[model samples]
Structure formats: structure tokens, C-alpha cells
Target: MSVYQVLERWGIKNYRVIDKKAIEEITLGASILATGGGGDPEIGLLWTLGTLARGKDVVLIHPEDIPDEVVGASVGCLGAPIVLTEKPPSQNVLEKAFKQLSSYLNKDLEVVIPFECGGVNSTVAYAIAGELGIPVVDVDGMNRAFPELHQTSWVANGSHASPAVSVDDRGNMTIIDTKEDNIRAETIARSAAMAYGGISWKASYPLTGKEIKEKSILYSQSIAWEIGKAVKKARESHRDPIEEVMKKLKETREVDSFRVFNGKIVDIDRDFGGEATKGFSSGRIRMEGIGKYKNQIAEIDFQNEWLRLKVDGETLCLPPDLIAILDNETGEPIRTDIMKYGYRGSILLIPAQERMRTKRGLEIFGPSYFGYEEEYVPVEKIVSKKGCQK
Candidate 1:
């Protein structure tokens, strides 16, 4: 079939092709925006590139352009990132999930909306788009990645992840339909993942094009690509990638970002153990401050995404905000699943998208939601209180 025929059949008037080079840039930026969570970038990159190599065209469309009746679902890997590496997925993981969900929903799915811009989910969504011969929506649930399934704009805005289907490589299948209780859905899904040996693929948060627009975060794909492009351009010019990230924020959103600390990873207490830590990686990182913030200690916490940042014992950033640990010079993200001891990186913090700071969002993804016994504070306010540039 011709490309024109494909577009006409899908009623897509505006879209962009996901070429090889574009995927690379998108992967880089997505990983950085993942905020220390989102699993491994390499795994996602290889899968996406493989899809492209097979002569399948992955197309992306604007959310607004999608007709109200088109069927959409949020799809991606669901498990511990560290565990996923140990148990690599079979080619049919997501496809099987799609089939199961389609059977359950009794609708032919057309588009896959990403849950967030992450090292893994972003590309996996595109790979599924290619496999299913559908266009991937450019919008997402969380602008940045979060730990739990319910930590998304979709659920916060009255969408439910229930009627969710999870499938594993071992052929395990479980359907979740908690009926307006998305947290219960997440708990059940995470349990299914752990029981299936730590990595499973899922399809859920089923919505129409109209529900997606009402529930999901907006313009996430382009934002991630732009962030990645800025970092790549800076690298080619032999400039600091951190500054390039700041430049993009200023140019695009007028949002200020900051270099919270420059340091070498001295210790990371990544909680690796029994039921408490199963299906999720949670812990604290201690970085020995260097360069301008020399002779001081900087610390941060994580549960998928970086939750907090403290500089010399002062709380500098909080959840809903983002803390990205990047290779200070190369501008590459250092992920939670792969960071090594003694790795040198700069901790950069970006404010959460305005949509994520809404009352429901803050209540669900805020510090209190993460078990932090403190009021939610914006990164800008926290930075200014510390006498840092806003």
C-alpha cells in the first residue's frame, strides 16, 4: 500500500515519520527526562531501531488531530528495570498484551499513547506503533516518568487504568478492573509483574481520542525530542550539555532549570530485597559535592523517578519536580538501573509540567504521596530560598 493510502485510511492529515536518526535523539532526551527512572535506554533503542530496520514506518500524530472515536491505549513495559535486564522480553510480549486487551475491550486498537517520556516506555510505545501499523500519539500521561502505574495525569483526571491487561514472557495473564480505583489497579498490576518474575508488558488506560486529550499530558514527545536535540547540538559544539538543557527550557517554556550540584557518586543505597522492594527500585543516593559546591554533601531519593534533592542538608527540590543526573560533560542521563559507583555527573532539576501540579496530581505524585512527611514545594521556590538563581 502507498503512504498516502495509509494516511487516508487512518484519517491522519498531520504526522511525522520516526526515522532512525530521530529515534536516537528522542531516546536520549526521553532517558534524561525519565529522571533516574524509566529503566534502560539501550534496550528500548535497540527495539525501536529493529522495527525501523524491518522497513516498517512508525508515524506520530498530534493528539488534537485524532478523531474522537479512534481507539487508544497506554502501553509499555511494567516491572523493575534491573529485573528486566535479567529477564529479557520475548518479541511477542507487547503484541500478546495488545491481543488480550483487544479481546477484552472488543475494539480494534489504532493508536498507542505513551504513559510518559521514559528511557523505555517512549520507544516501546513507538515500536508497538510500528508493529500494529498505527500512528503513535505525541502526547503522554506524565511529561516525565514516575514510579507507580497510578502516578499519571490520565488517572488523576478521572481516567482509570482498570480493565488493564498484563502479560508476561512465561505466558502468565491477568486482567485488572478495579472500577474507579486506579491505585488498586497499580498495586494489582505490580504484584502480577513481580509474580511473573519481575518484568511484564501491559496495555491499559484505554481511552478514545477525546478521553486522551482530556486526561493525558500534552506535547510530551516534541518536548523530549527538543531537549535531546539541544544536548546533541551542544555536544557537537563542545559546549556543556547542562547549559544546553537550560537554553531549551528558556527558549521553549520560559521555565528556569538549575544545576543543583556537581559531584561524584560515592554511595547509592538502592533498596534491593523482599516484598517491600519487589517490582520497584527505591533508595537514597549520597553524592560528595565537587567543583563549586565542594566539601559538602548532596543527597537524593528515588522510587523510579528522583524524588528529592538536598544540598548540604537543605531540601532543594521535591517530587512533581524532576531531578536528572547527567554525565556532566556528555549530557547523557545516568539511569537508576545502571549507575556505577564513582560515576561523575551533575544533578539538574526541572519543574514538573503545570498539568502535573494540579491538586489531584500533587496529591497523588507529590512528596506526601511518596511518603515524604512534608508539604509539596515547587522547585523554583525551593531554589530561590537557597539563594540560587530562579
Candidate 2:
């Protein structure tokens, strides 16, 4: 069935059509939300653009618009972000995953949802939807990106990512079924990526419309779209892109975000090579303050995505809370996969979505889960107590 026919059948009238410009804006916003991870946007953008060029319409529907029983699944690249930059997916990788998963379940997927908000993952869902003649939902598992598969609102809210199909560029496939064990699913999936030479595409989390509406981060794609549009407008008007990003976060999410630091990278200590960091790009980065904040120092640790932030020995942001380091002028994110010395950026910190801070969430992706002894603290609370670094 056609996308419009499916939408009509579901009585979902309030939906948006995704075009190339929309894709660009969404990718921009998603990359920032990726928090130094999510791989290269160029890979996903080119793939999605090619799909659009093939005369396919990518429809985006709100989480609330679908019927209770409609089935949906997530499709995106899963691997170490740094490895993905060197090895982009082939044309049929994601397609193969979807086909295999659908065949396994003996059902047709009616919608495509992103597992997280990032450059490549954000756009890959659109490509999959266009390829399958279905609509992509404007929601995701993680509003911000994380490295592990189990670290998502879906898992936090009692949903599972099991029975997932992981496929490599060369057609090798691994099917992971852990039933209710999302963590085991992640372990197996990670091993598959390592076996596939550090990158793989996955189709997972087959959820009904009701589960998606209740368990996923709702309107995440819309939030990303508005953030991207704001940055674009700011650039076009020659206004400060960081300021625009803060304004848009408040306007869209009503969250109190902070510009934690402005600085240029001075040192990088990468923990690459060896099986320990095989499926991830782990590192620590140091930045020397600039402008009004000169002489102050900021440090961040990342494992695929930015995990912790400390400025001159004071912890400012921790796991689950977002830490985006964006280019000061263009508002583009400086991903861990591509960051280097001498790069200047403004660090933006936003509180994790409420869904990501639930009791189960804290136990899964919180600071302790990353081996930090410090407790997870909300970014707003930290800002309120310390009054945001000047």
C-alpha cells in the first residue's frame, strides 16, 4: 500500500511531508542532540536524499495520530560512531534488516521510528519509511543519543528491543532475541558490530502504536526540527546560534538549558584500540575557556556520546543529561568521531527528558551505570546551585 493510503487507512490526517530541506534541518538539530555521538550525518543524509530522489515521499506522523494496534519498528545504524565515519553502510543493509525482521515476525511493519536522536539515526528512519511506503513517527527511543541499546526510554518504560536483526554491509546478519532482557540484546548486538568490522545496521523494537505513544519520547523529531530551524534562521540573520538554540529549547521543550562553556579544544586522550573499546570510541577532552570565561578549564569524557562534563573540578553535567559541543558560528555539533585539537565550540547542556530520568532509567544509563560514583543530578539543579558558568 502507498504511504498516503496507509495514512488514510489509519485516519492520520495531521502529518508532515519530509523533503530535502526538512531532512537537512532535522539532521542538524539531531546531531546537536546526539551529544558528541550519532555518527556522521553525511552518510545518513546521502542515503535519505537518494531515497527522496527516487520519487518516494517520506511522511512523518505524530505519536498520537496512529491507531492503537498499528505496528512500528526502528531502523538505524548501530556501532561505534568513529568506526561508522570510516565505514558507511551499503545500500541494502537497513533494507535487509527490515525485511528479515518482518519475515521473522510474519507481519508487515506499518511505521518506522528512530531509536535515537542523532545525525544518521534521525534521517535513516525516513529513508526506511520511504523505501517501505510507510510513514515515520515523530518520536524516538532516546530524545538524545546514548551508546548502548538498552539505554532508551523504551526500555526504561518496560518495552523491549529484543528479536532485533543486525545486518552488516556485506549481507551478514545476526538475529538477537533476548525476550525481556534488553541488556542481553545489547550485548549480542554489540558483539555483532565488532564481528562486522565495527559497524552494523539494526531493525528492532517492534512496538504497537499504543506502546510508542506511551513509552517513547513523544514529539522528539518535532523538537529536533524546530531546533534545526532556529539555528538556520539565526545563521541566516547573523545572530548568535548558541543563543538561538537555548531559546528554541525553552520555546519547544520548556526546559532550562545552559551554555555551560565557550572554549577551544586543547588536549585529547583517546582510549582507542583493544577489545575493551572495540565497539566504542572512548576519550577525554580538555578545553581552555575563551572570551569572558578565559582561563577557566572544562573537561568532558565520552564513550560514543558525551557522558560527563566537569569545569575546573566541579561536575556540571552527567550521564543522561545532554552535553552538546557545537561550533560557535554555525551551531553544528562537534561529534566525538570527528573532533580534533584547535576546534572551538560552545558547550550546551539540557536536562534529560522526564522519561529518561525514571527509576529504571537511572539504574540503566545513569552515572553509576557508567562506573561513576557520583549520583545523577539534573542539569537545572546544578545550574540553580552554581548559577551557570560565566
Candidate 3:
């Protein structure tokens, strides 16, 4: 049977035989879901596209198909994005990381799991899955992108990223076994990245299908894919892409997302001193709201991902949730590195996933974790108070 027939037999209606076009769509959607972080999707896109060019079949499997005993590894690159761009990565790094992880765990992974639904991590899972001749699981730790490793549902739901392996371009490697402390694993993995010239590929979060089913933000990959396809379809048809986004969020995620503002970026106060000094890009953005929001000002703070959003001095969203800046017409994500003065976009908001709304998740990645003195108020509540839809 042909691949199409096989896909049909597997009931893979939601699954796409990841090709060049599919990669582009997935990257576009994942980047928007990345919440203004996850690095440039181009980096991840290039890697996946290269793999596809080699005639590899990168198949995305639904999370429900993952068996109870089958194990998976969280595949990702950890470090500052600026550094990653400068240092680049070796094609062999992921393979080495996976080997080291498997050898340490004394078991091979049946599949790969994305740590988060960012552009890179989302594609990285597919990239590794294809390279390993395995399938990529649809589940992910974060439904939206987050900055640190520990902010994911794996940690929020009491799992860890440890017993991990970090590999550099030069074939050098470090095996980190934090004995279940995900935060310490992040610190150690981060320092390793800095030491290895600021970018390291890692295979961590070894989990059984059962554990992942219990802890992960199940079906996040499919959510990102559906959201992306909606935007793509809308754009191709010349419809309102933002409306497509809202519709996708409600239909696929069963969650309400809000378009809080539309505006032009007026200023970006980035931490310019931190190209090498800091491991992550930290900054604030200012935008002049347009149209009906004329004369209104909007602000957002970030450390990799959008952490806080405020309009005219009122907070509309905070950490552990999501804030994406998308092009008003095309629905493409406008990342921090790419956002420029005078760029027009709409600010979209999504509530944190239920798995990410737990008490521990809040303690680890809530607004306070980003240094906000105020507790997180649900975006729905905030929008409703403004008399918006639920």
C-alpha cells in the first residue's frame, strides 16, 4: 500500500506525512503558539527541510496511539537563541544526544516527545523521530511555548527533564542525572550550553506512554497543526486570518483565546548587553494601538517568551499562559528578534493549559516566577470584565 493508503488505514486524518509544505505549515503554526519565543522558526524549519530533502518520512503520530509501555524522549535544543544562531549546530548532535540518553537509561525510546510546542521543539521532535526511523508523538509538555525547561507540564505534573544528555557540535557530551529535580536539571543543562559555546542539543524527559498520558498536555501537536492549517486556509482564501485563529482555538483547543490589541510596535527595549553575558534575551516592547484603540498604549515584558501583557496600564495576560504577536494579515508570528519598530500586528492571548494551571505549575512558572508581584488572573476573567466573550 502507498503512504496515503497507510495513513488512511491508520486513521491518520489528523496526521500529516511531514514534507516540505507540512513543515512550513507546522513551523508557522508552532511559532505563533510559541508565544513570541521558541527562537526563529527558520532555524527549526531548515533542519527539518534538510532532513526531508534526504528522502526521510517524518510521520507525526497521534498521542492516543502511544502504547502503555512504549517510552519516549523529549528532544530539544536548550540555550539562548542568539547564541544558537551564532554557533549553529551539527547535524550529528541530536543522534549523539539520543544515543547517550538511551545508553544511560538502559532502554531505547519508542518515540520522541516535544518538550514544548515551540517552532524548534515541535520540529525537533519530528526531526529526531525521522532520523531515528520512529514516529513522533503528538503529545507535548507545553501547549504553548515557554522559556525554561521546567515550565512544561512534565514538570508541572511532577515529572522531570533529567537523566538527560546534552551534546555539542564537536561530539562532546554531558550526562545529567538530577534524580528527578527538573529545575536543577534545567540549570545544569543551561550552564552546559553556555560552556559549549551557547547551544546544546538534548534528549531528556524519558517517559513511558502511561506517564506521558498522565502528565503531558495531550494532543498539543494536533492543536498547533489545526490552528496553523486554519490560518493557512484563511490566508489562501483571503479571509480574516485572525478570525480563523479564534475559530481554531475554540474548536480544537476548546479554549477561549482573545485578540487583545492591534497596533504598531513603537519601541523595543532589548537587553543588548546580553549577547554573551545573558543566556536568554530579556526585554520589553511598546506598541501604539490602532483603529478603535487609537491613542492607547500597550506593553509586554519577556524573557524569551512573552511573560506579561498590559494595555493602557491594565494587565490582560501573564506567564504560564500565552501571548503571540501575529501579522494582522498573514497570521505569521512576529518574534522578538524579528519584531521591528513600525511593524503592525495583533496580540493574541491563550489561557494556560489545564495541566499547566496546577498549583505547582503556578509556583514554578506563574507571573510571580517572572518577577510580577501580582497573582495571575485568568484571561477569560480579565476579558469578561471588559465585557468580551467567554
Best by TM-score: 2
lDDT, residue 30, candidate 2 = 93
Model 2 compared with the native: what TM-score?
0.98
Off by over 4 Å in 1: 1-6
Q: What is the lDDT of residue 243 in candidate 3?
A: 83
Candidate 1 lDDT:
0.85
lDDT of 3 at 152: 84
lDDT of 1 by residue, 1-390 (tens): 534465688677788999988899988888888998887877878888998899888988888887888888988888888887777788878888887898898998878898788988888888888887888888898888998888888877877887889998888899988999988998999999888887778998888989988877777888888989999999999998988988887776679998878899899999642368866888888999887879989888888678898888889889899999999889998888888789989888898888788899888999898888889888988887777743
Candidates' TM-scores? Answer: 0.96, 0.98, 0.93
* Candidate 3 weakest ten by summed lDDT: 1-10
Q: Which tens-of-lDDT digit does each residue in 62-172 have in candidate 2?
A: 898988888889988777877788777788888899989999988888889898998798889999899989999999998999888888999999999978999997879
lDDT of each: 0.85, 0.90, 0.82
Better of 1 and 3 by TM-score: 1
Using TM-score as the yardstick, the better of models 2 and 3 is: 2
Comparing 1 with 3 on lDDT, the higher-scoring candidate is: 1
Query: Candidates sorted by TM-score, descending order?
Result: 2, 1, 3
